[model samples]
Target: MRPATDLAAGRPAAPAPGPDLPLDGLLRRAAAVAPDRVAIRTPLGDTSYADLDAEVDTAAGALTAAVGRTGAVVGVVASLDVPFVVAYYGAVRAGHPVAVVNPLMGDDALVHALGTAEVAAVVAPPRVAERLELLRPRLPKLGGVITAERLPTGLLPPGERGPAADLDAVACIQFTSGTTGAPKAVRLTHRNLVANAAQIAAVHGLDGDSVTVNHLPLYHPMHLNSAVYAAATQVLCPDSAPTAAVTAANRHRATHLYSLPVRLAALAADPGLGELRLDTVRAVLSGGSALLPAQARALSDQFGVPVVQGYGLAETSPLTHCERPADPRPGSVGRPVPGTDCRVVDVAGRFALPTGERGEIQVRGPQLMAGYLHEDGPATDPDGWFSTGDIGYQEADGHLFLVDRLKDVFKHENWLVSPTEIEQVLIRHPAVLDCAVADHPDPSAGAVAHAFVVLAPDAGPLDGPNGPAAFVNGRLPYYQHIRHLDVVDRIPRSPNGKILRRTLREAAAAAPTDRPPGDPT
Candidate 1:
């Protein structure tokens, strides 16, 4: 293992936990500190910390009765509702690791994730529970499907709580988005979750006085855990519309706005954006994917707040880097959070690269997962470094700039081409609303850049003399230029808003060879 000093210069060493708490301990601490504070505010109703904590206890008892075993894997269809929050913490409180199942997943993906996690029981919304019942035959190990609505009705005496002292025990199982490949279940321990919650809270400057607006389709545990750890108020905005989220944030006096890049892009392009007022918003945070710098600048310019982006994978408890809310760099995801170390390594994974040199980004941090589910060992090197499979570079001041996915970067002849580089330039074109780039197979150049673009509602003809292809090509080197451009209605993305590049790549490869570049389909 390399010594701590051998890592980045300004990076701090991981902090020693004075008294590590279990995953449920965060909620307990919050409720104890501020019992009457509104921990969660939803359009349905507001849940105070005291009420939320008490509800979690009741749910824990119900889960204990349903599973009837310690260390069982309990699946929770993670929806953006109070029931999901209750069931998630309740499962962990009842001595079971909660497997977070995305409510929007297809039947095959849903079965695969739950089955792979060895889920013995599930807590889900009524609709999702019904769906799970239909798939019960395929999931042999699943013993019960309890609707979240029925959690309070099921009466049972509370069993002994989970081993709260065992911080190293698995607390949650999060599935990867599988944009590049099959989704794998990532095992996060209690320590990993708790530490990351603290890291996120500190980096994002959350405290008891803070109010966060979760403008997402699903209730991400990172937002939930961090808010609970900081004893801050979280407002769940079920409405997917950006304007509605802004209204909710204003209504609740939100200090932080958490959203996906896709939605933020829409918000930036919304003609009504100028009419919205975010007087209390401290920062507009984009995650799950990169937000185009153009969109970020647009939002920042109009809203008068820093529109910052962050980077992380499910394996790292979903948070390792966040832009410092105070002094955010426009394009960089900022530096690693306290106690986290980030370095760029050569593509071959042999040697580390110097500052400002792009390579595979690797991270070493306490918040990293123990390993993937059913994996042999920890998903880290002998030195505790885990390859992030991302291409990025760190500035001398420690700000990290993402280039593109290592797996997504392809070669144009002898030179490497980054689709993100081309996409960034394409997005700058006034007519382009959104765009995605992929490698299209070529007879000579091994591969060339192909772009799929979504045009603005008011966009002029894109195939004219000064079109998107000509616009982007002029800005990029010959090897990195877009050789084929198709104007599509929308770019395919995952539920989390990550571009479905593999799908685009396949589409690009299968495209008719005779179609001319910059042709709108």
Candidate 2:
């Protein structure tokens, strides 16, 4: 492993708050300091910090009455709206670990997530509530389903608070995105959430004066917690159109713009992009997946602001590294955030590798999770280092560059082939709007790279000599060359914007041998 001194060389220090603060205390502190500040703005309405805090208190009281016990898990469907924010904080304030359920999940996936968490109660919007009503029989432990409309009625006394929770106790449970395998429930403590909030706010340079635009389908806790921790204002934009988010940012005079890589790529491709003016926006931030360097450069050049990205998983409070806004790097996720240590280890063994060598990324930090649900103890080694299962490399100065998921990498002729490496080259072609790469079985070579591409609207024939296949193959080595290429209207992605490689790989394996070929082998 890299020396401790080397890892900590230029990283910032931990936030001012100690590790003892409760998760709900983030809202309380923000409300106390700026009670009248506009905390959130949505198309429906606006909410002040004082009003939001009071609503959380009422919701907490109601949840206390509904759950009838402390420490029971509460499932909260995480939609990007004001009620979700209330229920999420309310559950934590009521001394319950809130299991954040993605509202877009299918019935079986939803049941699996809630069942695995053993959720005793759930707070959801009307749609999710209706679905939960049908699944309640499967969840015998579930005692109640509270809708957002009922959260403000205060079923119990308004001032009632649950028992004080320990800082190290599990405060939130987030299931993985399941892009690789079955989603696992990750347990994050109050300390982990709080520390990460502070770390994110510090890295993003958020303060009371900052305003942010969240243009996502589901509200991620990382963005919500960090905004509350910094007492910054948030404008929730539910519209999926890339231009709508930009318009919202301009309307709110937002200082930071947070979006997914998929959305940003769309924004980069939008013809109206050149006409939009992000006069007040300082930075455009993306996460959940790597934003293509070409897309990032397009946005940076158009808006005249830095486009930054970060890296983390559900196991690490969702944030470990964030690119510096002032000095953004095009293709790097930047160094580890304050109070975090990251190193690359050999994939087959626990031994650390030298700088610039591709290996599994392992992380150690205050923001790491306690463990996955049903696990015995913290999911780390004796020394507290957690293997991230991501293949990456770090520069001598500590900037991390992701190669691909370790499991997603396949071998061809005994040589490891990174799908992302091929995808990156494919996307650089002007005609290729988006793309995904997966391995197809081969008797002699073990596996060959198969690519699925979404072409630009005005692009011409793809099977010609100058097609994407020839374009990408010319830039790659023999083993990494694209063997099969298919054109699709869109690439399949999870709700959180991760490319569904498993799905694509399945399609590739089941494809007929008479399909179109890429380059003349």
Best by lDDT: 2
Q: Which stretches of candidate 2 lie over 4 Å from their true place?
A: 1-19, 153-159, 513-521
Which residue pairs of candidate 2 clash?
none
Candidate 2: count the clashes.
0
Candidates' C-alpha lDDT: 0.87, 0.88
lDDT of candidate 2 vs native? 0.88
Clash statistics: count for each candidate: 0, 0
lDDT of 1 at 404: 91
lDDT string, candidate 1, 66-137, tens digits: 999888999999899899999999999888999999988889989999999999999989899999999999
Instruction: Tell me the deviation in Å of residue 185 in model 1.
Output: 0.5
RMSD of each: 2.8, 2.6
TM-score, candidate 2, is 0.94
Q: Report the lDDT tens digits of candidate 2 across residue range 352-453.
A: 777788888888888899888997865888878898889998888788999999889999988989999999888878888889999988777898899999
